[model samples]
Target: MTDAPDQIPEPEEGAAADSAEHPESLGDDGEFGGVEEFDADARDAADAVYAALLERVGEGAPRPRLEPTRRAVELLGDPHRSAPVIHLTGTNGKTSTSRMIESLLRASGLRTGLLTSPHLERFTERIRIDGESVRDEVLARNWEEIEPFIAIVDAELEGAGESPLTFFETFTVLAFACFADAPVDVMVLEVGMGGEWDSTNVADGQVAVITPIDLDHQSRLGNDVVEIARTKSGIIKPSASVVSARQQDDVLKVLENAADLTESTLAVEDDAFAVISTTVAVGGQLVSIRGLAGSYHDIALPLFGSHQAQNAAVAVAAVEAFIGSGSVRLADEVVETGLGAVTSPGRLQIVGSGPTVIVDAAHNPHGAGSLVASLGEAFDFDEVVIVLGVLADKDATGIVDVLAGLDARFIVTNPGSDRAADTDRVAGIVATRVGADRVTVIERLDDALDEARDWATEGEKRAVVVTGSVVLVGDAIAIAADRGWNAR
Candidate 1:
């Protein structure tokens, strides 16, 4: 990995220089210059940035290589190296765990930059600084400064008869550049895909966190848990501290091997740390965590699910490893304040009341199972109407089978992505698993959610749950806000 430069390089001649000199045009202090009129202009510029990124290969089609991103960052003065990174990778819980780690670091009086994938709402949500989304002007300005360098790399790749940078590759460069421009004290990065060659892996992580490795993404990573585990273990850098959730024995063996090869110290859940107890509470739960250095008691985590409790344990261990190298115990107040303020949007998030609409981005069987378990433990609904949608590439059958165990009525719909699975196809799978009487198909997401919520409102102790895909959960959240579902 490249070492961080002693200082951020001055803007080079040409586009970079032009961008640097136009700070007022972008905004003052990365705000819209306090001019109500400039808000539209700032938003337009940010939209243009997303449009330009969408022109490349989409994130679903990730290129399993890093040199392209490495070269781009190298040209941009290696922005990714400007701060220490706590990198996380796995099938699920990566985003949630990354947020917790970032919060803990920020609470400890460090400015932090965070990068997570496939944002539920705006693309800007993927990159956060000090617990908030990076401002529109900042995102646009960084893209403008780096666009010229990206073009240079695109031309070079074409001349060599190779594909240009993919969407994730270019975005990885942008996120790193933004964080370095902010000059954050630390970074918590979530890998976009399998870790070995994911664009984010271009930066070496001081702490490598592996959430539970599972069988999702079989087409790209591997067809089994062990193969996927090996691919996910790629983030374990030489002599780095590795923290992982409890895994299948075979998966643990894979992580152990990776840590041994890298000469990194490996800590596993239930071994180095664990969730000792969890009590369901208002808005979320309280848990005791056996951390690497010490035990944390009755920590308030405002997220549901035992899986989330496990994720909290992993996050605590990760922060312990990063801040004190697993030697210094964090203050109890830091742990309480950090975790208390943590939020995992679209992961068992409550968007509405009355009929009680909820949204969870659980697209795979493992995530679906977690949703089922969390639902069972966290809510006492006599009836449930689940608004389900999934992407074409996901395991619709397995997901349906798992959710069927919840014994809830299902409304299948498209998640409004180009890759969304057909409503009829997913409905057929759901019907086969849970019987036709329990299944309904609604092509439009808004209509599906309306039907589910209306049905839920008819009975006492009934609720609506929107799950199956992140895009659908995002759509539901927006719809809930627009229709004032949460107000009811």
Candidate 2:
């Protein structure tokens, strides 16, 4: 990693010339044309593909191994190696950071492929081609072609007294194949979980971006921050340039050790680069970032929160490292256009109006903390109605503890997943923290949202926040669209 200078420097003449020429358009249609619609036949085919994937082991039960994915991809000609990868792994900001990286890359004239986890609405959302979700026809066709190779791997694993390729493992393979088929110039990959043995680790990332290591997925990743950091640091491959967000001292030590062992250079937030300042703006916030190669002033980021601003800084550095080895400054316009067009769905996203409805996927305590801070910074409300749901494996008590600080009423509900924590249990946790007078138990999500929206309508400066699980946020987004909450 390059050392930061005492003062920011202006770009030398022709510095922007080396940057890739801006494309006529970023996608086949246009920027933000939206996901393509599926015909009945295409929908059925896509549904069949999803059903087949569901038949395998679920994402919750990930096999902490890479050989199976390696074997499958190897048989498919190692599609993961087809493009230079910018890989990201972290607790809270992985998805958002990945989106920022992909957007910046795309704006710089690269045909980008992105893979993110646990989709909010559709399976195709996990794999994006040039800033849009992969089309259903393309997804179905790719699945049809890869099914044979997947079956071969499954039989091989089963023959060796092991389970079949798990959902994430196979999904990782499929995503790689899709990107390779698209022949993307670059791929931004987000790990499904901890990095070391996560199936996505098969690809050597040219730039490994770590976004703020924190405590989450304790049972699977580790029992503490150090253990989790050690697991995530596994993505720092040989001679890779690593860019990381601000982290705890202990976690930084773990990443530093891994980088040293791999002979990789590590650049951390506040050391290599930083968010100089941020001011809340109309739709989002205006940020000034001091990047590894250059300084960007007042870039408009459409996402909310200081965490997102931090994520943007890390992304800028990652792109700097990938494109110019942290030496050449990105074109000022590139930074402006890229950051300006970025969007992170379900992270502080407002899906409705009148009685404003916001949905965030802050399922863990660290994420919950960021959510509360962003809410305080971005929105003003006399009262907040929190429609909360939690997954069974999450730390409900810890999440509720963080949320209890808000001057808000809690409506505990299920997120419509089998993994949803019991409403009574979560409500009990909320009541203990905020008193019974502030708690409401709604067994169904739709009814819960309706009830919350009605209450918000009765008061001024009141909003409904649906959070706790990503699934719940997705459900809320759909419900908001269905009921025309934004129209009202």
Candidate 3:
């Protein structure tokens, strides 16, 4: 583990773990105890107050709304200025890439702060200070402390005839402020969606990274690959260096143009830095990558899938570029240790044994393609049963087309959220591609996963995947954890 600077000690020292409502001293009499033990009416009021503010994703405000966040910082005295950041945006691999970057930086002995979204189970997974969840008491206190600023942002926005900030936007602002207060050495900020309008882009980053570009978020970004890539390319700022994957000619042109527009230096994969020959194994991958700094061979990643290798190459390049050619070079052992320590939840996460339940938040065509490939090469299941869900916003036909050719019988379900693809609607799409006889649409995620598990018997090797949206994967993980599902 990296050593924390004297300015920012390890979280265990009571610096990062200490929060208002979640201090280490409180036993169990907090807000989440028994409803009868606390003020139910007060809690209900607070929930309602924030519920409306959380309604902004995939609904309204496709363009960047940095003003509200800016107002928030001003009210709080510009906390964002305190944190250094590596902002990441793309169609896929943002979370995995973020984890890799965070871990690599941490390996250099810097106190790392990672903030991600659509957590598998607990909300705390979204914010980690010094490699741990924010102590519950601390988060609760910060929540209360930040509430006034949020409410003020809401009022001013509403008075200006604009909708309130969405859940993700609020989260972006909160994370920036919280990390600034914790004063982490650097933050790995993953764009919640497309980069141009993503709330996380509000922060000024010293480095910008773009992973593989594909067709996703067409409604807000655009229909063409270049348009979408342009949206993601928005994260590139003046004076920042770019580390990106190999992209289509058109998409590559767009990325370069954006880099030029921002006056940021661009490092093209396969040209300046590249990942060479690769081999995938059960626990990790072995690949040789050559970058502007140097070449690394057979570096292993603790995560699954080939896409992760690409993400790792991008991480390795970013670290090298950010630190320049001298003092902060990434030692080969740091690369090994960094990749070994990195893990992203719900991205081919093997959550249990007995029947082998895996969770992946592969809601789009590109992601679905990667998940299908990973299953084929990594596991040897005689039968693969997929428990799937999706958002209404996704192109259901496109998603199904990619997974249909894979060896899996899908038990489809509606994601347990308003954004979920309608169960009947999703089933209709699946039936067209994979046959209705093989597709079953159940409204509940738990029921779908349970049915997939039961069919895994009969003296046959079977693997079950709970996938599609993070909401569905999250629900499946919650059930597995409650029942003590084992991943080994």
What are the clash counts of all predictions, listed in order?
Answer: 0, 0, 11
Flag regions of model 1 displaced more than 4 Å: 1-38
TM-score of each: 0.93, 0.93, 0.86
After TM-score superposition, the amount by which residue 317's alpha carbon in candidate 2 deviates from its true location, in angstroms, is 0.7
| Candidate 1, 247-355: lDDT as tens digits | 9999999999999999999999999999998888766788899999999998877787889889999999999999899988999988887787787888998889988
Ranking the candidates on TM-score from highest down gives: 2, 1, 3
Model 2: CA > 4 A from native: 1-38
TM-score of 1: 0.93
RMSD of each: 8.8, 6.2, 6.8
Winner on lDDT between 1 and 3 is 1
Instruction: Write down the TM-score for model 2.
Output: 0.93
Error of 1 at 2 (Å): 50
Model 3 misplaced stretches (Cα beyond 4 Å): 1-63, 325-328
Candidate 3 matches the true fold with a TM-score of 0.86
CA lDDT of each prediction against the hidden true structure: 0.87, 0.87, 0.74
